[model samples]
Target: MNVDFWNEKFTQTPGLYGEEPNRFLKIQLQSLSPGYLLLPGEGEGRNALFAASKGWKVLALDQSPIAKKHTLEKARKNGLDIEYQVCDIEKFIHEGTKFDVIALIYFHLPSSIRAQIHARFEAMIKENGLLIIEGFGKNQLKFSSGGPKNTEMLYAIKEIKSDFPGITWEYEFEGNDILNEGIGHSGEADLVRLVGRKLSDYLIKISN
Candidate 1:
């Protein structure tokens, strides 16, 4: 909910993380058919535009209005359409709409609400839908690659898995990688990547 910070950040650069979609997201979608995809904390529309290009109905959200402006500008140039909104991600997570895919790429949240938000995102996905994520991992503080400097915001595989017990993890890895997305992401980084499927409607509801 740090709107002012991220809004100022978007102004400082035309492309903070570059216009390219996350490589992990690109790879994961290749094997699946395009469907309704929701991207939260979507910073400049890179992933949204990419998904829309491939014929997926994309809804992108971020707290910064500037981010939406930049994304829409790029989408226009590329002849892509993405529904973008400027609002708190937590608020949007509780909406009634269901999606066929949900992706979170470097979208770090405070520890206080991380589990609840993650669980809500899980609830929003359709049965048999996919959830893919790529983010800075627990060991990222040792690396120079870009991520929230706050340790609590960094993801841990065990914690993330615990957040979504209903998920059938198709792929999971915590490793080091060389990031080259843009000026914001460069050099070696510790990352956690996962691709999971919500295979059925009979999941045990998350606790309050």
Candidate 2:
């Protein structure tokens, strides 16, 4: 999607994905210690703000300027400060920066570029860092709640395993579930959820 497309989406809805953090993401993040965290494709800053409030330094990236604006506004309202950037994932430069946790919730991209982006994120994670993901499954096309219409843009267990190789999967599953994330995502949905942890030294390194 282009900047204008997402900009319009964010502007059209007061809170497209709602003001609350994703339930799966919130529960997983709460189990870990506060540290540097990253949220990609974060619209309106719900998850970012939630992480910030929990004493985690959050850095959120999205292609929409409208998203950045709304996200910052919410952060300020909650007396929290977050680093939000408006840029395409294809052009984002990691600059050797690393994070303790990286969360991907409802973030989807074309199969043509998804693997590369996932690999890039994997490399940016510190040793033993966590990677939490929850997104639409191929079956989600049957539902209108949310997610990309293209099945190729959706996820499958094998695809995710291929994208983030070497990580120890603490949880991995593909199935259907109910979703109520603002007006954007609602009703029954097919989804893929994963929780993995990078290994430390003395452990076999997993390369994407």
Candidate 3:
């Protein structure tokens, strides 16, 4: 992720992406109770702001300092408190903390460290805690809605299963959807959406 490019882009467009949360994330919120939530690569704070509004203690991370400033400004305006940090995946220090829910909506990570991040996520959630991920599928190159132009940054269902092992995936979909979240994402999109729950070691074995 190039911080300079993002900083420049965000500086140009204050509301580059609209303020509405992703519809998929909004749907998941209907069933989930607010708690400690972590959002990685949370650009523009669309999801972070909504989660905070719902009483979730939100910790949002991104590589762009401008994104943090924008997010914090919005949080303040809305009277919602959210922690937005400008850090890369390597520098994010979360050792003894565990969260109730961790959402990765449209956060496209490079393939190099994606597996490691997925493994780390399994250990960071409380038992039976939720993990929600939505990204452009590998086949997304055909669509221009919005996503990493690089295929390596796109997700595949088989790869996802391998990345997040020892968990119960309650919902898994690798297909298409129409995204109208904001100016950043719109039109028909090829997407991969997964919602999983962390399980005990014994339970994982039994379920498998």
Residues 1-208, model 3: lDDT tens digits: 5999899979998777789887788899868888899899888899999989988898999999998899999899999999888897766778766999989888777888888887787778888888898999988899878888999999998898788777689999999989886667878999999998888757766866
Which regions in candidate 2 have their CA more than 4 angstroms from the true location? 201-208
Residues 97-182 of candidate 2: C-alpha lDDT, one tens digit per residue: 58899999988999999999998888888889999999999999899899998888899989887788757899987999999999
The deviation in Å at residue 12 for candidate 3 is 1.4
Which candidate, 2 or 3, has the higher lDDT? 2
Query: Please, what is the TM-score per model?
Result: 0.95, 0.95, 0.94
- Sort order, TM-score high to low: 2, 1, 3
Worst 10 residues of 1 by lDDT: 199-208
> In candidate 2, how many clashes are counted?
1
Q: What's the C-alpha lDDT at position 117 in model 2? A: 94
Cα lDDT for residue 62, model 2?
A: 94
